[model samples]
Target chain A: MSFLSFLLGEKKTSASVAKDRLQLILINERRGSSAGPDFLPQLQQELVAVISKYVKINPDDIKVNLERQDSLEVLEVKIEMPQPEASA
Target chain B: MSFLSFLLGEKKTSASVAKDRLQLILINERRGSSAGPDFLPQLQQELVAVISKYVKINPDDIKVNLERQDSLEVLEVKIEMPQPEASA
Candidate 1:
């Protein structure tokens, strides 16, 4: 029976199976420290302080996202500033 | 003269100046390894191979992006699969 089943293709495509496996691995890694470094919040706080010195901004207005591509890691910081006054 | 200059605000707003400084810092950081892990391409290739086993797919169809938000890092993998055939 096992031999006959092997001769026939699996009900699920190999791609779907591989995707499931990869998702599991990713979830496991997320549970570990692989998600991000401990200093991220600290960095965000410091950035807020520094930027606040010059511009009046809410802490929540700054969003920092780090993306790693190949050997390079890019730090993306997006700040939502209030619109400048209409006059002057 | 310097004291008088300080008394009068500089032509550029402090906010604009701060933005320039931050941009410079970000550019410098990009020149360093903060962008991503070295294994990204390898992982992408392996994923392509694995998925190809069950489904016919182009290597470029898969895109993996790792995002670090606060203390957690999320591995996001997006695969563009070809539409299924209509026939049963």
Candidate 2:
């Protein structure tokens, strides 16, 4: 399945490209808003503190971003859990 | 700055809540699309292969999601570089 997928180059579908582009634009728009990049570091720390209380995580593993589409704004957070230290 | 920001509890502003809710909705909407959850593992592998060629990263560190808002669809990709092995 992987090999066929690679050879066919069907991986990059139009829908996929459009989705990426739209997300990127929204992400940038949100970042450029009044909150700005400065808000992220502090936000990240707060989120990490809150989330870590429930699940062990390195503060660095937490990522937060903003997305605005139409009248709606979205805050996206992604955390990559570190192995070995997963117990912490 | 961090202490004051924390004590005030202003971190979870209205904008932040709206953003998080919208993003969560979009992410779920995109994931629930025709592509489905099965598509993610393969997509993740493909992305890891392509991105690793340029910058060293673990496949596990990469995260991707889809968001659809009104008429627009967005694809979000987030990658976390592992430390200690950062040289790779």
Complex DockQ, candidate 2: 0.03
**Which runs in model 2 stand beyond 4 Å of their true positions?**
A1-45, A85-88, B1-88
Instruction: Score residue B65 of candidate 2 by CA lDDT.
Output: 65
Interface RMSD of 2: 17.0
**Tens digit of per-residue lDDT, candidate 1, span B1-88:** 2222232223644332221100011111111113343333444445345434433455565556564333223344544444333425
RMSD of 2: 19.2
Clashing pairs in 2: A19-B75, A73-B19, A74-B19, A75-B19, A75-B20
Q: Compared with the true structure, what per-residue lDDT tens digits does model 2 show for residues A51-74?
A: 444345565655566644443343
TM-score of chain B of each: 0.37, 0.40
| Candidate 1 ranges beyond 4 A from true positions | A1-41, B1-88
Worst 10-residue lDDT window, candidate 2 chain B: B20-29
lDDT string for model 1 (A3-72, tens) is 2223122364433222111111111011111233333344444544544443355656666656443322
